[model samples]
Target: LRKSELKGLEIPGKLERLIATFFADDTTVYLSENDDFNDLQKILDDWCLASGAKFNIGKTEIIPIGSPEYRDLLRQTRFLNSVDGPKIPEHIRIAQEGDAIRSLGALIGNNICQVEPWTKVLERIDQSLDQWARSKPTMEGRRLIISMIVGGMTQYLTKVQGMPKEVEEKLTRRIKRFLWDEKTHVRINKETV
Candidate 1:
């Protein structure tokens, strides 16, 4: 793999030296060992000079990852606790436990937001079904609608990971309900529906 010029995050076993994703380098992520910010600051400063852009400190988030014990160790880092070290601006403080960080349109880290992706998919499906219910479309039309809309949802949402069994069942139930246009189960044959 090509080495990143903006090296920071350390990959175990020297696999890679940096972690980064770029859209013309507008946003970059660097991992500092513990809470050291001096290296990151210098890196950003260099990038700004080269690109003629300013780093936005206010929009920055410092999501702390690792076990609670690891976090405790991070808190005790000399740079983190130091009054003499280069100061981390107040708005760019490390995330507390239970805080969720949204990355690439997905909420991750601690808390209920971990389930946000599926919740949103479920909500969108319900809303769309409710609105489309008014049209009273033909069975073929409904089948087409589900294939076009709900089919994509199922494919995208379940692509990378297995969902909770209950959630999977609920999604199947919702689609089944929509297909039959029934509020309750009618005991119809599975293939017939």
Candidate 2:
């Protein structure tokens, strides 16, 4: 509601000009308190089309206006607001953890260290790491571990099969879940598909 908070709104076109000229001094600029998602989305889309700025689709979220989860999620990540564009899932397209896990999978398969499928995967991983570094860089000692959840099938195929009983037992102990956690990335099994 504050003047500084206006920077977060996605009011596009002449509406933005109107806001700046007349309501710039006003704390609250409301059209209708009962605006629906489609209505708000229309306003946002118009704003983005008029403005040259690109919205970071990976960093945006849409939540029920009054829900506690909405507020909590927003509070946790500031970029969740001001998302007035198309949504892109972060795991496949943006998350560094996804890239890291994919690279490790290649390494385990002995596909890395050479230039095959690993080359493409490595290139993507390099880009993801570079982006993450640019956003929130840290030294090795201070970096946080990104947990990339794997499916039971991938685990069974990668870690269980073709391994000694002792090693398989050790790996089973390390995995906390039997099911895969879903994300935006795709899991490929070349032999099957």
Q: What is the TM-score of candidate 1?
A: 0.75
Residue 57 CA error for candidate 2 (Å)? 3.3
Strongest candidate by TM-score: 1
Cα lDDT over the full model 1: 0.65
Query: What's the residue-level lDDT of 54 in candidate 1?
Result: 88
Tens digit per residue, CA lDDT, model 1, 133-178? 7899788988888887787776755654336677778788887888
Clashing pairs in 1: none
TM-scores of the candidates are 0.75, 0.19
Q: Candidate 2: where is the Cα deviation over 4 Å?
A: 1-33, 63-193
TM-score of predicted structure 2 = 0.19
RMSD of 1: 3.9
